[model samples]
Target chain A: MRMDKEVVNPIIDTILGSITSGLNSLQASMEPYLPELSWVAYLAFAIYVLIILAGGFMSILCRNLVRAMMGLVLTFLGVAGMYLLLASPFLAFMQLLIYVGAVCVLIFFAIMLTRNVSDGEEAHWPTLGALGYGLLALLAPLGVIGPLIIMHAGKIPVQVPVENPTGELGEGLLSDYVLPFELISIILLVAMAGAVYLAFRGFGPEKSKRHSK
Target chain B: MTTLTFFLLASLLLLAIGLAGLITRRTLVGMLISVELMLNGAGLSIVAAYKSTAASDVLGQLATLFVMGLAAAEATLVLAMILVVHRRFGKVTTKEISLLR
Candidate 1:
């Protein structure tokens, strides 16, 4: 009986451990390929970085609003790639889905809805007065904050990243972060409802006619 | 892979660009876009901090997720408000929003 129990326990352990064992074997198999893949990873990292900077500048500098939206899309894509490089593929996907998918679409709708508003002030290039304002806006934050970030960024100590980050993240959401998780859902619900109410309130032909006149 | 400094610097630049845009953008939608950019920078910095120094990876990720949620909420409210402004004021430029000025 004792011998039979011992044999059954080992069998059960093997069945339960097979998933991890498979992962270990897979990692072992890919060990040689990893060194060869390093260059590709570096190239991808560089491309993503360039994409981010270009998109940011394009969004900020472009005169046309639609063109600026395109730049925003580009930046979101680059940021998603950066998240993947940070070893969080889950966050990367979320970034793409939420930012590029939902938020951009919302902005597009807003742009289309308000496209007829012809404001000559906005259409003109920055004048001398506005140029000084723009310069102050650009330089003030950079001057005050840039040096502090530069001085301290290098001082941070990096460690070996956690294994199974995605799974752990899921667990933490349910366990440690249950409160905020629920709060987010509630906030999303309220925001959507409020947006719908605001949009449709007095949103009929009468309001349109008044605006048209 | 890139170092933490690179990510931090990237995030800082993003924030600066976003701030500049927010201050200078004449339209409500343009300002909203800049706000999104700023929020993205904040998320990147938070994750970078977590990736480098934090003991709990989940906390940083959770914060980023929360930021995303708040951003979505903010965008929805702001876009709706923009629509209302356009309907009421016939234009959406910051300069013409006389109540604010």
Candidate 2:
């Protein structure tokens, strides 16, 4: 027992000692350079992530349709904040306008159209059974996949960006991305028309008759 | 330890939550909401990758913008379809709307 303790304990101590000293060195090296503003920024990012988590939970788990829509609004806003932190202010603005403004409005309108759609219990499924299945589906794959990706992530790719942030966005869109830009606009127009037609189709005289038949 | 990895991991967690929500929710709208969460997770991951590896390339943000645009279009059409289903069947739960199945 004494020999086992001496040999095994020393091995474990060396491993733990290396990890602690490595972490300490890293902390010592970084402490001098990290600015006070970084703390605020990190704090904001933390808040944004929390908002996103709460919003997602509220939207998914809420029993009321209106509350769910509200949660969705918060989630979009939180996503927009994350975009800002990513240094893509333009994308962040687009997120606000497109997701928070347009998509949530669409959901709200649908909920109003079908009042009492959320009348039943949160779900008809047996709650515990569904939770178990849902957790099993998500956790099982993540358990198998997470370690694989982490193992590969150690290749540690390094890329240095050559252009300015917003400038690159403007140039990229106008020059290399012009075709896709116009194509997306066309797609939007088509989708808008289709949505309008589909939404109003049953209210139309001939379409209503056809649908009924 | 980098902020980039933090957001990426958060996005993955959000995606997992969304999948769980999709499985648990019986309502069509609820499922759609879960899908939205998943899409947001994808967009966040892309942006995180962009911020970390290619800060100058606007492609990542552009991809996210495209995702938002697609989400807008998808939500519009899906909600419209939901409206139609409600009008037709007077029910919104997955169990009741299995006409094709």
lDDT of each: 0.79, 0.75
After superposition, which runs of candidate 2 have C-alpha atoms over 4 Å from their true positions? A1-37, A117-126, A157-167
Off by over 4 Å in 1: A1-43, A116-121, A160-163, A204-213
lDDT of 1 at B30: 84
Evaluate residue A154 in candidate 2 and report its C-alpha lDDT on the 0 to 100 scale. 28
Per-candidate DockQ vs. reference: 0.43, 0.45
Candidate 2 residue lDDT tens string, B1-100: 3455567767876787688778987777778888888898899888878766744357777778788888887887888788888877897778888897
Give residue B18's lDDT in candidate 1 (0 to 100): 88
The superposed Cα distance between candidate 2 and the true structure at residue A198, in angstroms, equals 1.6
Encode model 2's per-residue lDDT on A99-190: one tens digit a residue: 77787788777777767355653434447888799888678646765665555552454332222467777788899888878877888888
Q: Worst 10-residue stretch by lDDT in candidate 1 chain A?
A: A32-41
Clashing residue pairs, backbone N/CA/C < 3 A, model 2 = none
TM-scores of the candidates, chain A only = 0.69, 0.70
Expressed as tens digits, the lDDT of each residue in A1-213 for candidate 1 is 356887899998998689658756765677653322344455676898899889987887777777788899999998888778777777888999999999999898888888822343345566677667767877777788777776774455565344345788889989989999999999999999999999898666677776576
